[model samples]
Target: MSQLCNVLIVEADSKNVETTVPLLRKMNSKVSYVKQGLNVVTHLQKKGFDLVLLADKLPDEDGFRVLRRIREKAELKNIPVLMMLSEDESKKAAFESGASDYIVKPYMPYELVARVTPYISLVLDRQKFTDECQRKDKIAKQLDEAFTEMEIMSRLDPLTRVYNRRAFLEKITDEQIRSRRSQKKFTLLLANIIKCRHYNERHGYECGDFIIKKTAELIHGSLRERDLTARWSGDKFMILLPETESDGLEIIQTKINKVFQESSFEFKGMNHRIDLSFSSKVCTGNDDLDLVLKEIE
Candidate 1:
């Protein structure tokens, strides 16, 4: 690799270290030597090495510990691990622990080279596969996050955090379509917050803003989660209550009136009880949502 032919070689025996170091060095490879498996994890994270050469048995810990740690890490898991196994059982355990390849102890110089070459190739292939999968997963996650953000943005008023006009309309359209498909009843409640205009005239613009925000909160808290509510304009609010009948609409309207009737606005000691007058219509056709809204208005 153009970046760095990095390898972490953990060998407790000095003779194997001496024999392997020179030949590995001659290949223009950078090597990290350690006799303990305990230090393997720290070195792998700190150094960002590409290959890990771990002896199956170390002074303090066995080779499987390092392999397990590497597999656990999302970043380091894909790095090639060339394990030194002494027996068939050791080899099986290393393979089970997700080692790419393993060579037995008392390994020859040429045998090490042969095994090392194929192991590196295997690591490169696995790394490529991993990178591709990550790239796709990241893209999918980004798309999902983006869609969620857009959906949230559409549903909420930018300043007031209430449902925006667009979101309100979209929900109305959805309810209309469903009502048409199922012939289920629905209602559209159009509200005129009359106090907003009075506040705008008597007080400064800030007072009007405060009034709108308070009105939004009062109504939002009064509604069910399934209810679609939005601010249509400075003084107008819209609610699309799906699967609702005339009785349900009247009941909801009564609840809304009670909620606003009990609440008081005391911002900056400017005490006022805002009145939000609402009018609604039971939907008969789905395709004529705009027409129904117009009739409600």
Candidate 2:
């Protein structure tokens, strides 16, 4: 492979270490040497190795015990471990103890490299597949977030930062259905900015936009947390107070009116007052939605 593979050699014999290191390095591999079986797991935990060349005997512990220890660890369990055995050592025992493969001692250099090649290739392929899956998942998550933001932007009035006409209509329709099922009443208040067209003509469109935004802010600030406010159309706003009676409607309307009357806007060295005409309807599920909308308009 083009990528350098990491091979950990768990051998205490200095001759064996000297013989094995150069052969593996010729094939573009980085090798880590640990003398004892006790250090194998610690070394493996610290670095990611593609293949582990475990000696049948170690200075401190048996190779089979080391293999079993690697298998016991959740993170180290899947790493390919090739056991190097003497002529008399049991190859069956190597496999049973979780060796991916085994090499008989006094082996040819080419034989050792040949046996180790396939496992390294397998590990590199698996890593590539895992990296691809993670990349795709990140892209999918970003796409989902982008779509969510687009949906939110579609529902909001860009000028006022409130629900637009289409969004307000959908919300009121759903609320109507809910009110019907619960047998509850809701208050729908529509406010028309009196002589807004004249104001726009007298001043500029920027000043007109400022007045609309200011009116929306005052009305929204005056309402309870549960209330929904929307910019229904040009120079018109709508409010939905859920499960509210006429008494509640009167209280909210008075609060809104008081806020509007107290508020003033400055434009080009002039103070301007906003005048709005309000119409309200107490609606149940039984009310014809189209008729109610027409009446409010």
Candidate 3:
């Protein structure tokens, strides 16, 4: 690796320490030595190391226990552990305890360099890939949320918080197609406000806006959950009642008319009762949406 390698040595033998530190330093590694297996866990926790060169024998405990402890921790688990064995017999035990590799001593300096370099480079590459994947996933989630909000905004009237004219066109077109396929009928009801222009001229545009919002709330409250409501244009609202017959259209119109008559609007210390003129027609599953809207208008 191009970076400086940090190595923790868990050997107390003075001859091993004298021989190993100089060999690793020649390759520009930062080496820390500890004599006991007990100190290994604490040093690993407080510092970041690239690899551990653990002796088969320690002053307090065996190297196998230390290796198991390192593997058990999530943060330290991926770091490569190379056990230093005095005999050829302990190779199997080293591999079983999750040691990445091992060395037989007394060993050559060049062999130590060869064994340790690949593990350090492999770890750095794996970490880079994992970080990149996480970053891309986060950006994907943010983009999905932004698109959802934009879709909702496009369908709604900004002032009244109800479906806009574009939404009405889309809904009517879809309903017309469904009616033709299933031979099911639906009703379209239009509620036109009386004297809206005169009311806006007398009170102010803000009061006119208040009336539109209140009209939407009243219409929404009187309709079934399955029904769709939209603002067709200035001072006009439309409702699409799916699977409803011609006889049911009058029942809906009467209910909305009654509610609008009963409701009152207050502006600048004046109280005013509103009026609505209702018109409704049942689709025969054959009419174009433009022709339907034109006939009602």
In order of listing, the candidates' clash counts read: 0, 0, 0
lDDT of 2 at 47: 95
**lDDT string, candidate 2, 1-297, tens digits:** 245779999988888889999988887688888888987888899898888999988888799999999999999999889999975457989999999999988778888989987987776677678878988999999999999999999999999999998999898999999999999999899988998987789888988998899989988999999899999999999999999989999999999888888889898888999988999999998899899989988
**lDDT (tens digit, per residue) of candidate 1 on 145-262:** 9999998987888767878887777777777778888899888888888768788888878888888888888778878889877888877888888889888888888998998889
Models sorted by TM-score, best on top = 2, 3, 1
**Which scores better on lDDT, 1 or 2?**
2
Give each model a TM-score.
0.59, 0.79, 0.68
Query: Scored by CA lDDT, what does every candidate get?
Result: 0.81, 0.89, 0.85
* TM-score, model 1 to reference: 0.59
Clashes of 3: 0
Best by TM-score: 2
Clashing pairs in 3: none
Candidate 3 per-residue lDDT, tens place, 128-234, comes to 67777877888898998989988998999987778999988888888888998999999898988788887799988888887888888999999999899898889
Residues forming the 10-long window of minimal summed lDDT in candidate 2: 120-129
Model 1 per-residue lDDT at 97 = 92
Q: Please rank every candidate by lDDT, starting with the best.
A: 2, 3, 1
The list of candidate 1 runs beyond 4 A from truth reads: 1-136, 180-184, 201-203, 286-290
